[model samples]
Target: MFGDTIAAISTAWGNSGIAIVRLSGPDAWAIAQRQVRLQTGAPLKPRFARNAVLLDEAGEVIDHILVLPFRAPHSYTGEDLVELHCHGGSLAAQRCLELLISGGARMALPGEYTRRAFENGRLDLSQAEAVGALIQARSNEALRAANRTLDGELTRAVGEIYEELTALGAEIEVGLDFPEEDVPYIADESLADRLEVVRQSLADLLERCSSGVILREGIRVAIVGRPNAGKSSLLNALLKESRAIVTAIPGTTRDVIEAVLTYRGIPLRLVDTAGITENYHDEVEAIGVERARAAMKEADVCVWVIDGSEPLHQEDVDRVHELADTPHLVVLNKADLPQQISEASLTALIPASTVISVSAAEGLRLDELKESLVGLVSGTGALDTGLNASSRQVEELRGAIASVGTGLKALGDGLDQALVSGCVGDARRSLSRILGGDRDEDLLHEIFGRFCIGK
Candidate 1:
């Protein structure tokens, strides 16, 4: 769609079997032909890889490579595209990119290729965002969720709701245009019922917000408790490695030890914080305790680790009490030893929390702990829908839902048809923004700026 050409190293910059230097735009094919010297002396063919020698602007050899070309409208970016498959490493790819740029192709900006795809009608705005999501996905579930969006699942879902709102707006507009009739085009009850359905549909999409985000971004779990309570041991057991130092000494963990566990295709970022207690052995220990509390406050769930082998101390009671209003799981740790604490006492303190007995040192029932953590964050639906709306998309859906609610209220109160129609129009505009139809240049830049160059 653009008059100029753009180039970049499509592959990651590192030593590998091959590195791709890509070019796109009107002059892509011409630039490739000028820089590539086919070994077979054959004409450059579209969709065929030809052995070639790449040359710089001064007529110097840069690298021996394969020249692959794609014609306009069929290639990515919907422009003539060329890929120079050169030897892997920073040198060849870098040199090839330099030559292409010198040959008149400008350096592609971060996510420029995908941005061009959006501009050329190859993908919608949500699909463009999905390309970045798929690139940054950290788990299998995240990948699947991103894939669904790239495949237009999100656009389709929003499209249905958008259509319903548009139809409602048209119905309301009929009465507004025929003010002389002084009669409603549709029954107020029927209009209210249809608007309610639209509101419910928007709410349903909004409901997927938490699960989608948790799937894409993962859940943060902070493991905290009194020192010598096997907090480090629990982290180690979950990660199946000695990621944190474990000892019988209290306040041994003087900092937050963080690691990640991918449980059931969802990432659980586990933070093992220093023990929490009023009694500190040193200034460092006190600081550690402060950090421990901070981690618990920030985490999606606090896995409160309590030593079951020891009698209930005031510290244990205080820590458990703190979790009363927080989303947390109580682990009565050291279960392999003779128990001195009863689950009843802790449950009575925090009647709503889940109490699981586990022996971290012996790796007892860690699977159950993981399962519980997954269930706590996974919500009560199948994650297969792959509708992971970003915070921006979620906010838009909320706005649309609010607008629909306003329209419903206006209709119920027998307000002017014009006002109700305006509400429907507002809802449609909000939904349109989600698909990039009504987005501005700055918003598009902010969204695509997060992408890596050559994407």
Candidate 2:
């Protein structure tokens, strides 16, 4: 799969000023040269752009294009590469791609170009994974976090730990080789101390993984409350648009309406669910109520909206009790009108949750509400640190931590040097896998599969 020359539309498909079609592999240059007629009628120069007339298999002019060539060992894929910059319309781009394919380049699979780059030593697994994260980032924080990973922040950290483990493993191996020696290659206390240090480093990285994953994958915030509690209004205000229908009708939102927005650089997925009510108008309302409950259950945080102008009702108390265990905030909506529910009374009802008053209808106190939401998710402002990790990376870090713990336990139990070394070796391999030093074909496929083609 990695041997064949591949090509795909590198830019988004649509009407625009220009679109890029990338071709990379051993035969990339030849395939591109076959489809292009150089204006100068001379050989194309590496790393230089040349005006060319793109030709179809039938020798018909498809489009006027600019050809940029990249030589081997200096290209993104570490192989010969070429990029065709043609008119942005689908007709011209598609025709040019067809010509390239007909000339011997095959369509690249999802993330295959980047996968080849990794296979060819242009990037490691972590950096390659960051490419997808960067493309999928929904906020500036997410983008910065992904950029940090792409710049080798995580890779360098892992590399440092891997080196330490390798050195420790070598010391243990030396001790294992000379069992009869009165003095070991590495003293037991010194080995245990070194392992403890490595364990602590892994522990710190794991500590950052929670905020890291949150930054990479935004938090899901479900807006749930009683009927006509201004759930839809709140969604509209947060999104700064009328995304949901706001009306006096109790069951206006019969299903979940979700939108993505950033709160202080933290990506937030606001989900406005059907108002929770004891009475059902019909089967549809009942289903909506059920879905609302499900959304609250799945969400990382829940915004419980209450009508501040109305007296506290039994339904409000019931909803509060139901979501008592979940991470939630009580929103007193309709603050623009006369207040009927006292903040003290609401706080007493839900002592564990933070309470905020706002007028979703008038867009009052929304900035404060957003800040509270950010605080709810980020306990220590770790998102500001710009660190990020994927679930796979977190899992590997945990595995390494566990192995180090096992080795520490073995050392404490006066186990054989061989057993301790074996544990250390396991930890080393786990860290190595994070950077693609150890091969895991299925894992590689899963990581790269999330990326778009021509990446």
The model with the greatest TM-score is 1
The TM-scores, one per candidate, come to: 0.92, 0.89
Alpha carbon lDDT of each predicted model: 0.87, 0.87
Where in model 2 is the C-alpha error above 4 Å? 58-60, 180-192, 207-212, 314-325, 406-423
Error of 2 at 164 (Å): 1.9
Residue pairs in clash, model 1: none
Error of 2 at 349 (Å): 4.0
lDDT of 1 by residue, 85-173 (tens): 99999998998888888889999999999999989988898889888878878888888888888888889889999999888888878
lDDT of 2 by residue, 1-455 (tens): 36789999999888999999999988999999888899996888999899999987778888999999999889998899999999889889888888888889999989988898899998898899888888888778788888888888888888899999999999888877865556678988999999999999887766665566788787899999999999999999989999999999899999999899887677788999999987988999999999999999899999999999999997787877778787888899999999999778889887877889999878999999888887777767477565577888889899999998998898899877788888899998888888898898998888888888878
Ten-residue segment with the worst summed lDDT in candidate 1? 379-388
| Cα error of candidate 2 at position 101, Å | 1.3
